[model samples]
Target: MKSFAPKFVWFDGRYVRDSEANVSVMTHAIHYGTSVFEGLRGYWNSKNLNIFRLEDHVKRFRNSGKVYSITLRFTDRQISDAITALCRKNNARQSCYIRPFYFVGRYGINLHVTEKSPTHAAIVMFPFGDLFNRNGISAGISSWRRINDSSTPPLAKMGGNYLNSILATQEGKRNGYDEAILLDHLGNISEAPGENIFLVRDGKMITPPSSSSALEGITRSSVIEIARDLGYDTVEREIPRTEIYFSDEVFLTGTAAEITPITSVDGKPVGNGKAGRITQKIRNVYSDIAMGRNKKYSRWITPVY
Candidate 1:
């Protein structure tokens, strides 16, 4: 599919033509990956564009920068306002993906980075649809192990840390799987390359905790809350790799992936190889809340239009 490029991007506290939102080739983030980022989704319901969990995403974005000593020049409020303004400026009339990131600028091949280091920030949005096959997708256990806090801190959305995901995803593609699921250092299920993993068994939703090297995903937390609110039990525990193969249903969640089902794992069908009923229910509620259809969870959405 052809990618949809936005006409403008928010760069360094101002809106700029996408082509002008450029950085130097010698940028430190380019060479060393000393950057942090976050992904957000905006849903348009024909009348209004609502950004899902805007405050939470901005808070995490700032905290991600703090984890790497990349201090942002703008306050959280400023960043949040810019995001909404950017969506309005783009005239986004459909569901879109938003990316907000900051990176260490050109300080000339320095290994030491600090809060005092020069940094550049940018926000970009593109008209996007499903990141994976929403009906269902196939996955495989990756040979690559998930990075943990002991090494580079998996909880932080650092750019450098994604190399592990990149390699695992590439391996999955080579093996003809739609995606890759990774185990933590302890050989326990962690998460998918970019999304958190969840398995349903005996009518309970279970997922690995951050201790298992899973990123504390916003969508993951939302699903847990939504599930409990819907009278289903939710759990966070160290899940074994075998549990995925045996679960009644399996799914992955993220700002991009949303709540995509995993129909098969390691070529084995997950609960008859289709999106489970419970998974569909939660996904429906999530979509409703995101698209401004559920007024009860109105606080979770920020209207841009």
Candidate 2:
């Protein structure tokens, strides 16, 4: 916490100090895990600042809130503006991660609808490094399966849905791996807990479609577009359970995880146990765009400085 910048946070339509901001202890979301949030990154380019895919991230955040029945009083555009303001207030020019949460509030054990329900929002910006373990994230297939879409829509990035991810993530850590890849109920490849999974085979890129009970990550789409521009064919469909075992390469993409190459899966070497060429290229392109070096993709970032 010492490295955290002394800065401002937007909460319930107001900006407050990180240390001073407070919410009710008996909040409904806190108890019931009925909250939605987004993780966004602001990069420092030594000249101008960039918040990667600002609009898209806010739109997804808004959509997540809607899925959980939390009404966002602000539009995506408005929320984007507020996020920019909060980042600037924090003077967060050093590649920061921004988090915005909308949660149910007040004392309600039975959760009796909007009559006793209150919604509160909080936005926090902090200097964030790689979310995946920085030693380049060696991974394994998780014993924990992803929650079924019928039980809870995987499309919605709700808080309750993360328990499965949490268990899988911890499983990886306990087993001396950096992350976990969870399978869907049908035993098909789903995703890493917080990142979208992609595989490279025969010089082509393939990832599970949005229907694969995945979070539809912002960075995942960014990498796909950049890959297409780089002249590589990108495919999205239902990736099978054995697809990963034979893939030449594997990687996960997200705002926090960024682009991490997977060296192995379920104890087997992926393409001679090394990062594939296509995966490395996509990672490089994404790094360039997020670093404010690519003018062709400048629209993805909003300069805070």
Candidate 3:
């Protein structure tokens, strides 16, 4: 499952060897975690001899930087070209994860926004694999709650926000669970460590809105649209913890994990402890789209060759 790492990298406005893409010790981002990034996958497509969802992911990469005050020096078009070039350079035409990070290069403790300091961007691709341990994982309601929006910037994909996720995720791993279902300050079901939550009741799909302490996920919206197309009504609103235990089914979504069914929570089975029918349908559709099996989204794949 291992992939090659570039000896050189694209950094500080140019592609340098990885050994040369070094950051300063005093870098603000290094000291305070003042960086933002995005995770996206380019799925292998046999028909196109490339990977899927390249453009959508690159767009999010640019938007993620803008939210964190990391002015992407390169235009969206430029970033897109860079990703394509990197994939072709590495001869990666398979399931691969692409991470684009933007950080403050020059170090300091100014604590204030520094638009003048050097900024850095890098795009790295690696072999992609299952994010969950296995299919239909049993999740648990974490004692650790999500960080309040006031405590950290909620809209940006900043590195600091992940500190909260780390705590919640570690809590679950210690408890022998696949993942953590984080609640908001007011005790409403928020989201997983990295994915959005969905609740199923009476055959309808309901999820917490962004105001309910959920990240506005790109894949979340896609699931909503796909669910509607599948004839299931979808609702985005505040969901209570009580609803989770009582639901017929539960699931999570993200760019990395896509859609994973949760059969149990807190040691209790969700609707009979098997993956729900609707959950299976959506998972199949998502997989098909990502693997280049869906003609509807044939345009989403970008051929590396």
The estimated TM-scores of all candidates read: 0.97, 0.94, 0.92
Candidate 1 lDDT by residue in tens digits, 1-305: 34445688999998999888889999999899999999999987879889999999999988888887898889999999999999988888888999999999988978888999999999999998889988999999999999998988999999999999999999999999999999999999999999999999989889999999999999999999899989998889999888888899999999999999999999999997899999999999999999898888899999997
- Model 1 residue 68 distance off true place after TM-score fit, in angstroms: 1.7
**Which lDDT values do the candidates have, in the order given?**
0.93, 0.82, 0.78
Of candidate 2, the 10-residue stretch with the lowest lDDT total is: 107-116
After superposition, the stretches of candidate 3 with alpha carbons farther than 4 Å from their true spots are 1-8, 47-52
- Candidate 1 lDDT at 86 equals 95
On a 0 to 1 TM-score scale, where does candidate 3 land against the true structure? 0.92
Best by lDDT: 1
Clashes (N, CA, C under 3 Å) per candidate? 0, 0, 6
Q: Best-fitting candidate, measured by TM-score? A: 1
Pick out the ten consecutive residues of candidate 3 with the lowest summed lDDT.
1-10
Cα error, residue 111 of model 1, in Å, equals 1.5
Q: State the lDDT of candidate 2 residue by residue for 136-197, as single tens digits.
A: 55788888888866888888888888988999989998988878998887778889999999
lDDT of 3 by residue, 91-133 (tens): 6755777777888777567666655666777877777778874
Ranked by TM-score from best down, the candidates are 1, 2, 3
